[model samples]
Target: MQIPTAAASGRSRLLTSGVALAALSLLLTLHAVPSAADDDTPARGTASMGSGVLAHEGVHGQPAATDRTTQTEGVDVSSHQGEVAWSTLWNSGVKWAYVKATEGTYYRNPYHAQQYNGAYDVGMIRGAYHFATPDTAGGAAQADYFVDRGGAWSKDGRTLPGVLDIEYNPYGDTCYGMTHSQMVGWIRDFLDRYKARTGRNAVIYTSTNWWQQCTGDYSGFASTTPLWIARYASTVGPLPAGWTFHTMWQYTSTGPVVGDHDKFNGALDRVKALAEG
Candidate 1:
């Protein structure tokens, strides 16, 4: 999608507000990748507005209000971040990064190789995420596509497992036209295939509202799947059925780092363990 740029002054103000709000949410509620190809780019999409701004909101049309806070063990990035200073990020205490590698079934972040490997080179635990496009393809098909591109992983201690970004559908139909049971099956297909392929379950990224609205608030995955909850609130609040606690909490959309700010719910050792099998 072609996002029209506003006049320099207005654009600057909007972007600045977006960045500031994103950072503030962190201090207040806490908070909250990648390069792709020309043809592979998803139409710049925005999140449904309500309580808090989606990290991926703004930039396409206008800047979004973001949660701002401090404390950054991890961050997720996509093409929107452009060129990142991985070493700088590492030096500033960013130990882990989740980079956007694939979306739907075909779109691949052309910058996957750079961001994924660059973070690894700097000794940071690195992982890649696939934006689910359940509306466009079945779960297994998209899982296969993601693994082939960005989901592939190595047993190295610093390489994190693949992630499934299953929040809002950027295209249309937030639930992808699937009923609650169907949504559960679709996610199960993706998760099961991913585990079979890499011998590790993919981490789930989503908000409580999205999960409830789309998946009927299924908690079955809580026993086996690691939860990465996104909420710009002081506390995580009510979570999906199965998850007792979030393994990761995304607090803000902007931070000292280049992407959305995140916390790994534990110490460096735990983060390393998460990175390992």
Candidate 2:
């Protein structure tokens, strides 16, 4: 048997060390890079109310104390909230709620019944909202899907009209790849179809910046459609061009409860009035 020289043994040790270092570097690179599926962006047809708002505007401090005193407290929830604690929320002074019902024509909240009915069971005025995805289907088609699923409205004095959550697109382009005119037309189609199906005007939920960018600040719907302006601030700030006032304001994404906090523009009685309508 031949004996190995010290130089040969040293060379072998260096080569082994080099291989181990390469493996360690590779492992670290893999750990640092995020996979496509690991993206926090919600899947298609699963985007919920304020999904884009939280992504875009981030969470702000609570609304002004004076603002809170005059307006009715509410919340908006999605499947992300799962089965909500409606009773706890009611005890927390939440007077109303909007539960996500559908998204485009592809997705519906599996927990819709629990959240929607649960809120009502707790003596809170509850309504459903549809997360609009114009790129997936026509506005009218999505509206039909919404109403069929859970967005339907009746003047039962405990339910408010459904809302069209039209804001920053979680999937792709900010305006869902449509021109300003096209975006406006698509929204009009959704609102008109929803009204035709439910005999009530669907509330339009959007941020001022998103409305300005996507719809060219169109004022055509201001007269008929109720606006639910999203602004995570102490005040609502400037509204979209034609809306002199917002019916509801989503004030904060990080509320103490299960979902985003909102405020009706008036007292608790006004909220009941909106429900009656």
Best by TM-score: 2
- CA error at residue 199 for candidate 1, angstroms: 0.5
- Per-residue lDDT value at 63 in model 2: 60
Candidate 2 stretches with Cα past 4 Å from truth are 1-35, 38-40, 66-69
Per-model TM-score on C-alpha atoms: 0.76, 0.86
Give the per-residue lDDT digits (tens) of candidate 2, residues 1-277: 9898999999999999999999999999988878888997767767877778878877764764656457889999998889998999999999999999999888989999999999999999999999999999999999999999999998899999999999999988899999999999999999999999999999999999999999999999999999999988888889999999999999888889779999999999999898888
lDDT of 1 by residue, 1-277 (tens): 8665678679889899999998887777542122355344337322211112263332211112342433337878887776789999998888899988888876888777889989889988889998887888899998999998878878889888898888876555667788999999999999999999999999998888888888999889998899988876555567888788788887667567578777887778888888776
Q: Global lDDT of each model?
A: 0.77, 0.91
In terms of lDDT, model 2 sits at 0.91
Which candidate should be chosen as best, given lDDT against the real structure?
2
